[model samples]
Target: MGRQSPFLLQIGVFILFFILQAATMRDRIIGGREAKPHSRPYMASIQFKGKNICGGALVNRIWVMSAAHCFDNLRPESMQVVLGAHSVTAQEPSQQNFTVQASISHPNYNMETLENDIHLLKLNKAALVNDFVRKISLPKQGEDVTPRRKCIIAGWGDTTDFETHPKALMETNTEVVSRASCNSSWTGSISQHMVCATSPDNVKRGFCSGDSGAPLVCMNRAVGVVSFSSFRCANPRFPDVYTRVSEFISWMEDVMRSF
Candidate 1:
């Protein structure tokens, strides 16, 4: 048999890789659903260079709770939080922007494993409480958010895959999936540090790319931070994973108090 050209072998490998990625992504889309719109006064958009970078909830006048992935390799000076923004384009310059003084991602965070995906941002000045700007309550220690309970999620991420960026300030509803179901779908990688949520039938209710760092809040309490979605939205076999806020409460309080 004749030897294959080196360039031909490389091209064949690239094609195979592309096909595998596509197949994985397609599986996810078939399994997921669209998330519902949410309404909360405490949610804020974290922007960088005029782009919506992540979602955060006001925890106090000077601090916001978000996902550690939001600040991964990002500098404080590059970030700004927009409060009282009903929509990105409609934001009032005066009410929308605040400078960030510092950020602290969990010391044990592992990006590859998505472990401890939590972070806190310190605002340069206290946020003024108003009808549009308020603080979200954190769940008390050991409080459990039961599975299958309805919860709210909000973000500025893309409305769909084809959309390169996120829609301006949107909210959605999804139900917490059972740990059993989530674990089965997630295989052996799901951890106590993570939680899963999705809408029934995987119809019009799931997190999309860029929704990372937003909250999966339940009953007005902070429960989870939107983390990874299976390379596709609404994958039936895989639920959207979030960093369980309850698992990191002590760490959060310690960081906030130290600042």
Candidate 2:
């Protein structure tokens, strides 16, 4: 789950619904099953004061990608990234913890509209890659996920609305929703910078609170960053929205190179 920044400013009436929706988003993988231990090596548990607050993907040995909203009002010094984690609550031997040397949110990020919600965290030290810890591949610049494509979302979020977060990672399969359909459902608030997905069988199975900043893995590539969902979460009427990572490939490359 993620916290809404206090800097949320009014953009327009059309965007107001999204602004309010974002305020209540916590980010979880609803209706997902437990992931196999060490199966998602790239998954990163973003923590603050040793508490899991958000999820992320290890894109490189030194760089972790997440949602910009997750770091709002949070300091880098207090943040940590735990890689190779299957059970976030366990003191697993394979888990590698790293201090966040820096937290960089996209320059053009908008707290109100939830646009450009991508973020990156630089690790204090390079990760030691191994069988249970490795980086995931990134999408090509400007690459777009086609409608109806199936993708997997994994995180340490609750599987049900009332259930407490499980110790093991959870994941679910979702199908990409077309921009037009998603925009219609959201009243034209869906932007090109974002992507939408829903359960293939129309089940209420998608992201909810606590899964923010988690990667939407498609074709073995990290294609989207969990942004926000309806306040009701996993509601069929409102599909989950994500920051289209391909749209910010250039920005991410620049940040990694300059920093």
Candidate 3:
């Protein structure tokens, strides 16, 4: 259910079959369920004008992390970040909102292959951190873990294809798979910059359309940034792809410190 970014996707099959995928409407969760309010405090709802556009996270008081595609060609002045929120459309008393001052996506971001699909949003002012508005810890640079580890992904994206997305945040448990396994399943579709995760037994428990740029949290650390699911969401063999967060730690530190 991943849409082609305005940027080019260099893969041949993606280019040849891109039109077919584009015709489908953005989809969402299949077997994932509702999440508790404020449970994922660092969660940030990236909005354009007044509508939710993507999921992001507060890495620090004034910096947000999300997929570059979500912000590509979008004006920062028209964007906002909503923290401490469970519902995408609702405004809550406990939530803190901030106007985006600016944003920068990875220099090498490729829409075609979804390589380096990360970005950072700078908030005009530091958010007032509180019980429900704290930042999530990031993984150490170059961190590595064996596959089959369990992780959780949360978002306000759809719960099923063609259905209205839930107002409340939805979450699902997914397992990390080895790159070799992922590559074999997609056959040249997996990129080095991407990490893979999915549900076992073909259960409909995976990220879907509108779930892009969401956080993939493991062991209380932000391990990956939701990149995109393949042509379909929650498919048994085609796991969801993510921008590995650990690999970008150096870039993130440099970006935050520079600006």
Q: Give each prediction's root-mean-square deviation over alpha carbons.
A: 4.4, 7.9, 7.3
**TM-score, model 2 to reference:** 0.89
Which stretch of 10 consecutive residues in model 1 shows the poorest summed lDDT? Answer: 24-33
What tens digits encode model 2's per-residue C-alpha lDDT throughout 130-240?
Answer: 989999999888899999999999998766655466879999999999999999988998999999999999888988844989999999999999998877778889989
Candidate 1: C-alpha lDDT: 0.74
- Tens-place lDDT per residue, model 3, 1-259, is 9888655655756776656554443435568778887888999988877777788889999999999878767898889889988787777898888898879999999977788999999999999898889898998888864699999988877676554668788888999999999999888787767889999656878876447788889899889898877666788778888899999999999999999
Q: Is candidate 1 or candidate 2 better by lDDT?
A: 2
Clashes of each: 20, 12, 4
Better of 1 and 2 by TM-score: 2
Lowest lDDT sum, 10 consecutive residues, model 2, at 5-14
Best by TM-score: 2
User: What TM-scores do the predictions have?
Assistant: 0.84, 0.89, 0.89
lDDT of 1 by residue, 183-216 (tens): 8887877788888888755665677533667777
What C-alpha lDDT values do all the predictions have?
Answer: 0.74, 0.89, 0.83
Error of 1 at 175 (Å): 0.9
Please rank every candidate by lDDT, starting with the best: 2, 3, 1
